[model samples]
Target: MKIIRSRDFTGSHAWEALDIASMNGITTRLHWTDQPYRWHVNDGEEVFVVLDGEIQMRYRENGQEQVAVLKVGDIFYASVGTEHVAHPLGVARVLVVESKGSV
Candidate 1:
């Protein structure tokens, strides 16, 4: 077992670990005050869990924009190649697990 300290990372309120060889990883986000906003497309499917605070999923439709807010204890998912974005609604924290190849 391993313990990752939240203070390990400076300026960023998040930590990540995954199957380096398999390109799978898990990431934890602190709060929006720490720029909890994230825009990433995983190499594979991924899941997001709102542990604390709030988060919002952003996406574009017909050149317009849309959002889905998620509160604590909420969960969501994204598929590979599906362009999407995420950001904390306020001082929100989240955990995301996904496959990331070769570190």
Candidate 2:
């Protein structure tokens, strides 16, 4: 058993992550970043939760770009075929759950 503090997390580089678990082929991770992630669609689904700081989640919908500002405690669900990316406003800690080995 481990007690984790989201606000106290850090990474060696942008989007660096600490693996939390892998169950049923789904991987859970804690990520720390101050940079934007590349746009990509998950093979299955993705759950993005902000633990600290904020982020602008940008995605393509109906051929148009959309943005959602996510604060701490906010959760964003990306269904399959959703082309999206995350831009951290600052040092942000995020919890991400997705299929194992997914980019």
The segments of candidate 1 whose C-alpha lies over 4 angstroms from its true place after superposition are: 1-33, 36-38, 61-64, 101-103
Model 2 lDDT-worst window of ten = 1-10
Clashing pairs in 2: none
Alpha carbon lDDT of each predicted model: 0.56, 0.95
Residue-level lDDT tens digits of model 2 in 1-103: 7878887888989999999999999999999999999999999999999999999999999999999999999999999999999999988999999999988
Any idea what lDDT model 2 has?
0.95
- Candidate 2: clashing residue pairs, number: 0
Expressed as tens digits, the lDDT of each residue in 35-94 for candidate 1 is 444555667777777766677778665566678888878887776655567776555555
TM-score of each: 0.60, 0.97
Clashing pairs in 1: 18-25, 23-99, 23-100, 23-101, 24-99, 24-100
Error of 2 at 21 (Å): 0.6
